[model samples]
Target chain A: MNTPLLTVHELHKYFPLQGGFFTSSKEKCLAVQDVSLSLHKGETLGIVGESGCGKTTLARMIAHIEKPTAGEIRYNGQDIFKFDKKQLKAYRRKAQFIFQDPYASLNPRLTAGTIIAEPFIIHRRNLAQDIDTDLENIMKMVGLSKDQERRYPHEFSGGQRQRIGIARAIALRPEIIIADEPVSALDVSVQAQILNLMKDLQDEFNLTYIFISHDMGVIRFISDRIAVMYRGRIVEMASNQQLFENPQHPYTRILLSAVPRL
Target chain B: MKASPVLAVDNLSTWFDTEQGALKAVDEVSFQLDAGDTLGIVGESGCGKTVLSLSIMRLVPTPPGRYVSGQIALNGLDLLSLSEREMRKVRGKAISMIFQEPMTSLNPVFRIGDQISETIRLHQGCNRSESHHKSIEMLRLVGIELPEKRIKDYPHQLSGGMRQRVMIAMALACHPQLMLADEPTTALDVTIQAQILALINDLKRAMGTSVILITHDLGVIAENAQQVAIMYAGKFVEYSDVKDLFSLPLHPYTKGLLHSIPRIEGDYCRDKRLPIIPGVVPELSRLPEGCRFHDRCPDVLPICRNVEPALIGQGFPKRYVRCWKYQ
Candidate 1:
């Protein structure tokens, strides 16, 4: 409808393969190749793929965590790669990435409160006075108790740790959140809670999500549109209903069939 | 029904002596598997599904873990009473186990062929050459391509799916009567999982091997297992035929779990919020006195908090449930 919130054009990321010291020839692994997608505001775009399908790599490249070897990523109207340092900093503030493993992502030594406030400390330097209040609000918003703020990541259970991760992701109030397998590590019952929390936060903050998971049930539940990736390429992309009901690609069909359905 | 069960676990209780207290990880759990039947143990993490399997395999670490009580009878032989040295003979020959993570389960240092061949040699008492040939055959049996070449490849060189296939091949190398697959496909992709599952089913049918498939996924249990045990907080809260379990789940926890999962095939209402069981699973040391799940149960009763309900059978084709409402 309107100009897409984010536009990716023929994105590619090639990882160069290292050989023995004597070997002179150079080779590369094409992780993501010729990928193009547009994300509308407030709608979740789910990227579904098996491990090593480059879904994570794609997410990282879009988040600017990894530089694309070729092609362009446009945030709003401007090319993200072309942005200057100030604009890049602003872009970083607007787009945040939630990693797969909450245990590994959060620094074990840092207090939950300090981790949540780190983003604001970096992006909004003038907001130092309100950091504590901001951290408290974010923690409360993500269903964490106020008393748990001083605890380290290891103190919390998997679910609570994930809530802490979510708290950190939304601390800066980013418009776009790229969550990669956010609930995969959680138990089934806890997964529902986190999924619901994410949905609620999206409504509350008017957030657009780029949700990535290999679990079909989760992707089906959360996404408006779904893209099925296979071997560094998107084989199918459609509305959730269309994709699930009429998965056109052979790989998508196989994936759908493989999902252990209840 | 007259034939003796291949494996019968009676009142099996596994307790972990933690710093806090004695944690009853698997309490009074009982089940029987026929020669070729598949029994699926479905439960969330920390629900003792893993511990139950580990206990059966005699793989639970001691000092912390202790078999407080119960009998594990495999082919009428009491496994619990057996000496550690004797149990070692039974581990791979009678009952083999496939772990959740194939990557960790496999040794990275050894070639796939060497690992499989080692298992064959250990259990079958075959020579190196015979074991090597059998290893290749095992690889072929599990549907791995280019067995000769792939055999030489290390665990790191294989894909997650292929590694799992290798694990299966190694597990089945000795042709064990019983196979304990503890979330064997959990670490694999859906497509790959399906392939592995199909492979297991095929092997089970061909070899007449009994299987204990452990997973949190109801879908996997539905497709693979003939019987299903719904475990919660270290107890088999419900057990029944898979068809009946799906059609009429008696326990509140089982119902909650079945409803909680988002269905891909059936009529799925996308807008409605998933019905959630409130509260987390109780910590093992400080579990509630009566019902471990009463805190999270939707149909909680006054008696549920005070009196622990025994897992009693419902008169019919054979169904068991542990709940006040069932009583």
Candidate 2:
């Protein structure tokens, strides 16, 4: 647990609800309010919240896809917010994000192989020929056949498309992978397959995942630790088993009660 | 046996004639739902869950998709025989639908009030103001805050959960006898998913609305459905009471599905690794000849690969399964 990979302290993200160009001010909707958690090396910390609970916003900030309004995001003891331009460029390789919708994330025109190899082309110079071998390895790791790499996103089913998304995310071999609702779009039966694949890949790669999801069952399955968010704040953060067995926060209890009994 | 059920679908088969080949989407599926009864259809994507709902409504577009063979009897009236004009009358007035994507299901350009009121005015022959009042009441019934002001907002303005609630309100606007909810909460978050399920159940009990809840989540089905039908490769592999299906699943596929869910309750994961059902659902165009699930099934006897298993024995009183596990 001492091997902390990333630490977020008093993170805040506020979006203006209403505004005019010059005349009027706006009401601020605190999207993420004072949320703090630490991600250990090779560990998955699952974040669970309702639709507007700012989980995705928090994820975007952590992945540096969006700048935090206020907070100190420490990556390997260095404040990521205060990173120099060169250091920030280096940070992009260490933390990558896997978006929720596979179809949305991927370009329809590009082949799966091209999509996976794009990151390599962006970061590593003179890696053109190596793309094929790297792509094949990524595709195999995510349970896709070699033949599947040539196909477009539309050709594959929802589950298969998600697999390609996973391949693209892990292709860069980032230390931290932030998967945002990766399996929510999938079917219940297909969900198990994707989750299992992720678990396997996590162990094999020794990767850290900030798994974001709405399904309590899924969070329980993949996460070592769980954080329950409410309107904007994390009400409870503990081990998965502890939170599932003895949920303390009122919102957490409400969420637990709402999970459909199987 | 003397009294036929309220809704009887016998040997229902729907197919799509794509450029590739004739893909049988829903094949030889049969079931009956009495008045005020809920039948949950569970299946993986591309297993014809949506097609089943659309086929029953006779809404599958004609060019690519076709309901080739089926007898859909609603209260002893054969629905498949009805004309499109007649089906339109029966659609909102008799059988309503709450589609999966709420934002798309409701017209975006129109106001929420207009969409709901338009449905009421068209179906129930109410005036504009009257329909508006009724729509607002429906919105309040679904627990939307400030129904009057909220109903004026467009679908895009509202959050995902709010949009879903508006969709529910619109679907119930006409007070149909039976409602077909196809992955209704698939787009919403878990907490919101629970609220929507509870709302549907409350409305069903209050209005005695018989429902065919089609979803892929067993947890949602187990929570809401009294009866469940397990679909695989466009066929019903198992059907029974919810309790019975959970307690003693008759089919291997059903058992695998039930066990595969990463449950929060009970001792599910004995080992550290989650219990996973390996292999993906087969492509519809390249389906196997015999038992559809034979390839992925854990307990595969020799008979599984060669011949298809018929729905044999009333497995759990009203239960049925198309697996040799029961035989």
Candidate 3:
């Protein structure tokens, strides 16, 4: 509506395939090529693709974890890559990433409470007294009890560990979240629970989501709009209704056909 | 004329003896597959779909896993009665399996062609050059282009879809009576997945090889299998024609699984608050008494919590259910 919340124009990420440090032969691997998309203030954008299809690269570029090789990323009318150290620090407070494998994402040495509070500890040092309250509220919001705060990542089940990851992502009350295959590691029943939780949190916090997943069924459930990526481009992008009901792209139709229906 | 029964698994139970307790990974699972029939096994992870397949092939380690009881008969020969050495001969030649992760399954040290040819040589008692020729043929059957040249390539050089085709080629190398595909297409992309499924269907029809396709995706089941077995908590909740299972899912757990799947059709996702069956499945070691699904079932009754329900129904006459509500 109002110049869209975030705009990505002609974003590109390429990794050079080199022989060795001394070798002159260098071949560039195109990961994300000329990709572009935008999200409203609180809209959920579903990015669907096969493995190595550049969806993850696009998400990382949007989150500013990886700088783009070409094109523009406008976050709130400011170029994300152009931000200096201090401005970048402020931007990190408003954006967070939830990795696919919660078991691997969370440090084995850290407890659930510490993992969730790490962002606040690093960014909001002046408000250190509020960490305890912040930890409890985030825990409850993610459907985890206060007792779980003291436990390590391995002590909890896969589903519970993912809840801790979700809590950590929302710890700073970020305006946008890039969730990369959040529930792909869990069981089907547990996957449903996490999807429902994500939807509830989106409504409660009005957070914009860039959801990436290979599972079409899951993307359809939590996404407002869906973008189907192929080889290295967005083959189709439409509202969830339009994409699911009338997918124009052959790849999108094939993807929809692959998802198991009752 | 219908081909006779190839593999018949009866009341097979696989259990692991742990210090904590005895965990039954596959509890009293039984089914049969005739020639040219694809029986699809659908269930969530940890539901023993893989374990059931492994047990049929006698590949489970005896130190951790014990078959406990039940007969696994393949063409009137009891597989469980055979020695490890004897079973090894029967495996791959008579019954072969293709795993989900093909990269790990294939030996990286060897060429894809050599691997498939090795299997052919071992089972078919052919020369190196003859097996090499057959390997190329198998690759072509799996829809790989220029099998003669591609055979020399390593597993890592191929894409995920191509690696899976190599796995299928190896499984079909000996013209086995039964091929066990354990989520064969799960790791591949959607378009590639369709291609793999179609390849398996074509090969099965042409060779009259019975197939057991184990996957959680019902779409594959619908498009491939003639008979479907729905498993939950290590037991068959429902077994019916694929059409019947899709149209009238009898068990509450089966219904929940089917409903939970997001459909790309009309009016399905209207409910903004996604209908999720509450609570995670209890650990297999600590499964609920009586009906295994009673804990998470929405329509749970007192009797469902106390007594186990039996699978009862004759062929095509009526629906069979375990819940007391049906009674």
Candidate 4:
């Protein structure tokens, strides 16, 4: 209704392949190319593509995990890249990322409590009465038990480890969460639990999400708007129903039809 | 009566003697597969689906894994009774396996041509050039372009899709009667997954090879398999025709799994929180005394906590469900 919470224009990212030991190659692999989209408050933007389609690169650029090779990303009408040190720090607090691999993303040695509390410590945002209280609340918020705080990452199941990852992402109360294939690693049953939990958290916190997955069914379930990427380009972008019902792009149609119908 | 079935697994119980008691990876699992039939095993991780296939191939390690009690007969040949050296003769010749991660399964150091030819030479006892030509033919059959040139490439030289195709080529090199494809497309992209699955289906029909396709995706199973087995906590909770399993799932676990998958077209899953089967799979060792699924199952009765359910077949339309409710 109002101005978009975040707007990306002409976004591009390229990784240069090293030709030799001491040579910087002129040949660069274009990971993302000229992608533009706007995300409003509380909206879930689903990006679907096959592997090596650069959807993850787009997510990384949006979350400020990686700098775009070319383009403009404005957060609340301010250019995120052009922002000064203080502004960049403030922007960091507003956006967070949930990686695809829960196992690799989480620190193995750290307890569940310390992992969730990491953001608070990094941003130095003293949230709530005490750190333990916040930890307990975050754990419960993500459907984890308070008793699990003492356990390491290896002890938790695949689904529970993902919850810990989610808990850490939302601990800072970010405006946007860039989740790259969050549930792809989990079992179907556990995937349901995580998707439901994400929705619940989205409703409660009014958090905007950039949910990326190769799975069409998962993308359709959680997204308000969908973007179909093919070979580092956005082939199509439409609302959830429009994308499913009347897929305009050939790639989109291929993707939709590719999902084995039940 | 019915071509004598390609494979018959009678009460297959593959247990491991772990330090934390015996890990019953597979327990009392029984099923049959006809020639050219695809039996899809759908289960969560650690549900013994992989172990079941390994047991079939006689691939499970003896020090850790042991066959508690079972009869695995492939075309009237008892697999468990065969010695290790004897089993080797049957492995790639009678039965071959395709693993989930093609990258890991395919030897990176060796050329694709050599790898595929090795399978051929080992099983069929073909000469050097003869095996190479046969492997090239296999590659071409799997739809890999320029089989002659591509065969010279290493595993890493090819893409994920190409690598999987290579695996399929290698697995089919000897034209084994039974193929155990464990999560064959789980590591692939959806589009590539579609291609690989279609290729497998085509190859199966042409070669008349029976496949035991193990994966966690219900959609994949529904599309590729004739028969479906729903495994939980190391036992098959439901076994039925593909159409019947999807249309009318019997066991609580099957129902839960079906509902859990978000649909592509329907708005049912969108209206509410995705219906999930709560709680994790209990440890294989030190399992609950009663129904293994009782703790997580909805509509569970008090008796479910105290009673174990045997898999019983329902008359008319051939389906078996292991649940106290069915019992």
Candidate 5:
């Protein structure tokens, strides 16, 4: 498809299982195994699964937040793992992450403006003067008032805090945004608002998204194509239409049917 | 031709005395639930669905929470007039509750078996050994595999779904006449949530237990509840049969909630934005003067902002709605 924007090849992540005193051996928990997917330039690819199903692990590997035990992540035809120090730092600027819990992901001590300006302070060292303007634009883009920047995370509601999180994600104008269950913690009414905001921002910036969530409704609402993960493996991958209308895999059918619809 | 209701709540108001003012968490809400019927109370967070259930159970903390005025009757007996000691007997024996987060609700220090057995023994007055046996049976009934081994496992040893099943087992140990499930599946996965919902429905059918299922998901309510109540800002905005409610939702807030949810099966609108209620829920202490939802109501009238509308029934089978549009 015209040389995909990003390609993940055979990603595998394993954590060592802590054995009891009597059993002294190397045991591993395979969090994500042989998971591979390609993301187009301006389309959203949703990875959906239940808790502990390795969706989060796969997202972390794709975002380069966590190093895969065995795999290759190619961004713009170059392996991300093989990047030198300078190249890796540049790659970090190209991709940003929005965490699941708005309450825990943000710093409680810092004001919203300071938090949004952090990416610029860390990455664009010479853009200190433009940080304030950049932060204000990003906040407005995410539907937050300019005055809200002075308030702490605790002062804002869950939906507003999530908006602040989104503002921070887009502050650096990253090419790819990996949002992991970004609206799952908010109320239903507010969830719709956040999802709508995300769609608008995606179009305005022409951004690619790797949206991860367990909610079929949310995934269906936001994604162009979806990859279903089960037990650390992608059981089915298809467009949103095909996956919802004619699910091929039994597990996929079960997952689709399990979603409570209005 | 109407059977006696298993539960009838009249003029129930639960308020909390916060630092600012008296916060009416649950306003004067009234509903009658027949035995074996599932009544779903659906609302967003801070809408007082949880507080309504808590008020029914008399579990609202005393210092901050106070029952303004209400009558909660279970099987024609008023629970509000009962003493603390007497209410304790009615808690686990006649009525039991399942909370939202199973992780925190289950005592981590105790084994799964001990917690279930404790409920059984306390309510049924059974001996230790008998309670243990019943606990195992309850666990098996909830479809937990390897109940014999799982009985010895602590709450931490189980997954989220398994922990919820243990909570169910504890709640159903005595076969209580009424079960109050407050967002019981909110914390679990979709597959596990489906299983839990099915199990609850099956058990309710088998035991003839009426359920007051509290959740924010209208979809869940449609599948499980026969009667549905839509709450907004601590008041029952609409109450009707599930089929009728879904087919003909009267209140603007109810319609807003129904339309706000994205459907999985229907025609996909790829680019269309979801319709959302604009304003946030008002704080309990400073609720809007008239209709709690008038600020966000699309069909709002001048009267709606000045005077509160009473919940009035429309016709047969009692379809109740509190809105100026209806008046």
Candidate 6:
């Protein structure tokens, strides 16, 4: 739609097998190989894969959290790697990441308010007057009370910690969020709450989501379209209905079949 | 009298004596598993599924974790009455357990063969060469390839799935009459999860061993267990046949748990709002006055806020539901 919100061309990330200052063994592990995709303005793109399949590497490269060995990422038709310092900062501001482990992602020492307000402070947004009000609103939107702002990460449950993570991710009102298995670490009942909250937030903010998860049920429930990755490449990409119904690739079929149904 | 079940637990309440208060982790949980039948304990984290299993195995550390009151009978023998020395003998012989994380469970320094054979040596009193030979057979039984060579490799040398298989081999090495698998496949991939589950099923069938399968996934419970117990806040909220429970879940907690999961099947759309239980599982230290699930129950009555409901059923004939409405 409108030149696609984000695009990746032949993305490749290779991790060195052995690293030393002098040794150049040339043996590398292909984490992400020849991955390519385009994100729409306000749609959830699900990337499903088993552990060690390099979906995280792809997400990191797209968010510019990690550098790709070979490929190009264009945000609004301009190559993000070629961006100047200010342009990079602006791009980073528009794109934020939510990690799988909420406990690890958040700083344990800081209060919830401080963690959520860090984005605004780091972006150099002069919201000293309205920052408190904004933080409270974000917390409320994530199904957390305003009183919880004073609590530390250790005080919150797994679900509440994730809510804090989401509050931080959306603090800057980013157009795109690359969430790497955000609900994987939560319980099923809590997972449902977090998933519903994400949907509500997406509708309210009109944000695009790059949802990555290993659970087929979660990906099916959240994504508009799905990409099934095997080894280090996308074996199949299709609309949610088509992928679940048809699933052309053998690996995709295997993945769909592996999911235990009630 | 009819033959007794392989394992029977009655009014078992495992509590942790904390400075704040007594945390009832497994409160008055009662159930039984027959020969070769898998009794699946379905619950989210901190719902006491793991604690119940640990209580059965008599593995809970005593100073902190004390059984308030109950009986844990394995093959009609009271396990709770056993001394630590005697319980040690019962552990790997009559009962065995496999934990969730295989990587952490397996000793990194020990070779796979040594780990598996150690159980055999400790339980069966076999010599080193005999134990080593039995270890190879055990590995082969669990479908590990090249058992002779793979047994020499350390825990780190194996993949996550392979390590789990090794763990299974060690657990089954003693050929225990009953097995406890606590989230055995939780850390593995879905495809590997399926394989491990299928392997457990096949092993149970072949060995005629009663299994207590505990997990958070309803799908796993539906596929694996014959009888199912839905645990919440240290109690069995719902207990019934897997088919009956899935077809007609009675407890609000059980029903909410069923509806909460995003099924990978028909009529489930993408990105639509899912049915959710209102809040998180309450901390055991500060559980509500009356019903544990009343705060999150969609169909809460005024009585539910003040009066707790007992698990209502006659000896698990059809089903048991712990709800005021049912009572």
Q: Say which candidate scores most in DockQ.
A: 6
lDDT of candidate 4 over A4-52, digit per residue (tens)? 9999999999999877888778999999999999999998999999989
TM-score of chain A of 3: 0.97
> What is the Cα-based lDDT of residue B30 in candidate 2?
91
lDDT of 6 by residue, B1-327 (tens): 657799989999999999989999999988888899999999989989998999998889987999999999998899999999999999988899999999999999999999889899999998999999999999999999999999899999999999999999999988899999999999999999999999999998999999999999999998999999999998899999999999988999999999999877765464477788887788999999789999999899999999989999845575899999888
**Which pairs in model 3 have colliding backbones?**
none
Candidate 1: Cα lDDT at A228: 91
Candidate 1 chain B: minimum summed lDDT over ten consecutive residues — where? Answer: B263-272
Give the alpha carbon lDDT tens digit for every residue of A155-180 in model 2.
98888899988888888888999999
For model 5 the local lDDT of residue B75 reads 92
Q: Supply candidate 5's per-residue lDDT for B245.
A: 96
TM-score of each: 0.97, 0.93, 0.95, 0.98, 0.97, 0.98
Separate clash counts for every candidate: 0, 0, 0, 0, 0, 0
Model 2: pairs clashing at backbone N, Cα or C within 3 Å: none
CA lDDT of every candidate: 0.90, 0.87, 0.86, 0.92, 0.91, 0.92
DockQ of all candidate complexes: 0.64, 0.56, 0.53, 0.73, 0.71, 0.77
lDDT of 1 by residue, A45-138 (tens): 9999999999999999989989999999999989998999999998998999888888899998899888888998888778666997888788
lDDT of 6: 0.92
lDDT of 5 by residue, A1-262 (tens): 4999899999999987997778965989999999888988889998998888899988888788899999899999999988999999888888889999999999999999999888888986786668877887888888887888899999988999999999888887889999999989988899999999999989988999999999998888999999999989999999998999999999999988898766
Instruction: List clashing residue pairs in candidate 4.
Output: none
Runs of candidate 2 with Cα error greater than 4 angstroms are A1-3, A22-24, A127-132, B1-4, B126-133, B144-153, B156-158, B266-271
Please give the range of 10 consecutive residues that has the lowest summed lDDT in model 6 chain B: B264-273
Query: Ten residues in a row with the worst lDDT in model 1 chain A?
Result: A17-26
Ranking by DockQ: 6, 4, 5, 1, 2, 3
Better of 1 and 3 by DockQ: 1
